[model samples]
Target: MQTDVPVTDRTRVRREPARGRYDRETVHGIIDAALLCHVAFRDGDSVFCIPTVCWREDGHLYIHGSNGSRMLRALLGGQQACVTVTHLDGLVLARAAFNHSMNYRSVVVLGAFEAVPDDRKAASLDRLMDHLAPGRKHEARPGDANELRSTTVLRIALDEASAKLRTGGPQDDEADLSLDVWAGVLPLAVHALPPVPEPGITRSMPDGLRKWAGA
Candidate 1:
């Protein structure tokens, strides 16, 4: 059984409370399925939201970028941030336009960011590569000293988070359901394409690539 995350003022799901999910399994599942996340934070007097690759390991969510990046610098300075990951499953078409909506699983994480220690930075980078392309990390060369010094990895503990999901067919009003119009869900999903190797590559395709392609 999974435990629920304590709901705080910021983590509360206000609209469609029935769609809210606080269980760790559900929240982690959604986070794991997403390849990218939008992180929102305030800088001085302006608010910024930037999209970047994100991965969860152990109990923390990690995102990396060039050391010179404003976002990374700000995060390294201990600024609070909000990260969101969403997967669109389908488009729900209802008889009435107002009732039309999307089927999606989304997670919102609110917390302060912390920089990964220098000693653990390499391992964190490896985990990130594996998360993006499992098993590929072993085949690639590790980051050099300069590269490691030029990059920044920030993490936020998964202490405050919530997941919201909306699934199933369109829910049109009773009167609209009887109208002469199509009302259903057009399912959507992400498909991995066959891998394309770089020019002059001599090594055979790895099992990881094959598995990722569903070959």
Candidate 2:
């Protein structure tokens, strides 16, 4: 697990090289912390990037969409794509405007997508549900045959991936450090809000939802 992934021409980090990480842990950590990803792909004269829910397992990233979705259809056709996930930890304020930045972790994955076979779609869907909300798949009814058939799941290997991270206070110029200006980090985080049960459901909140929300 400690092995370093190869840095190919496309995966190399040229700017702020010190912030780039190619190891499995860094890349996977960023991916695991994120629940959504932006996927970009090119089709003919148009370039499209769409935000979608994502999950990872066994060194592969999974995304699901309608079988008739343009993005899914393009990916299922073996188009190359880029997937990116980012976590904004805080906003870095500096005495100098130029030094203002963000404390964050981000990952970029480059690869071609392949459709998950019909036999494996169900399990993948379960994994996705669990990833987003632990224990959800078990508590909810399983997808029916028609539902399964109408959905498309695609996977991309986490092979050509890299994570870039920034942390701590901004590095203001020596002169700016002496300036009388407010400088600090405003921390941010994503947390589950209290659950709002669906209308007409009289049962108590499920253990799964409560546990997932840490409530």
Can you write out model 2's per-residue Cα lDDT over 1-215, one digit (the tens) per residue? Answer: 23376677788878898888999888988888777999999878899999999999879989999988999988887877999998999999999999899999999999999989999999999998888678889888899999999999999999998888899988999888789999999988876786677899888876654534531
Off by over 4 Å in 1: 1-3, 202-204, 210-215
- RMSD for each of the candidates: 2.0, 2.1
Scored by CA lDDT, what does every candidate get? 0.87, 0.87
Every model's TM-score: 0.94, 0.94
Please write out the lDDT profile of model 1 over residues 1-215, one tens digit for every residue. 23388888888889998898889888888888777999999888999999999999977889999989999887776778999999999999999999999999999999999999988999999988877677978888889999999888999988899989999998888888779998899998887775677999877777665434531
Candidate 2 residues lying further than 4 Å off, grouped into runs, are 1-3, 210-215
Give the number of colliding residue pairs in candidate 1.
0
lDDT of 1 at 86: 92
State the lDDT at 39 in candidate 2: 97
Clash count, one per candidate: 0, 0
* Superposition-based RMSD of candidate 1 using all C-alpha atoms, in angstroms: 2.0
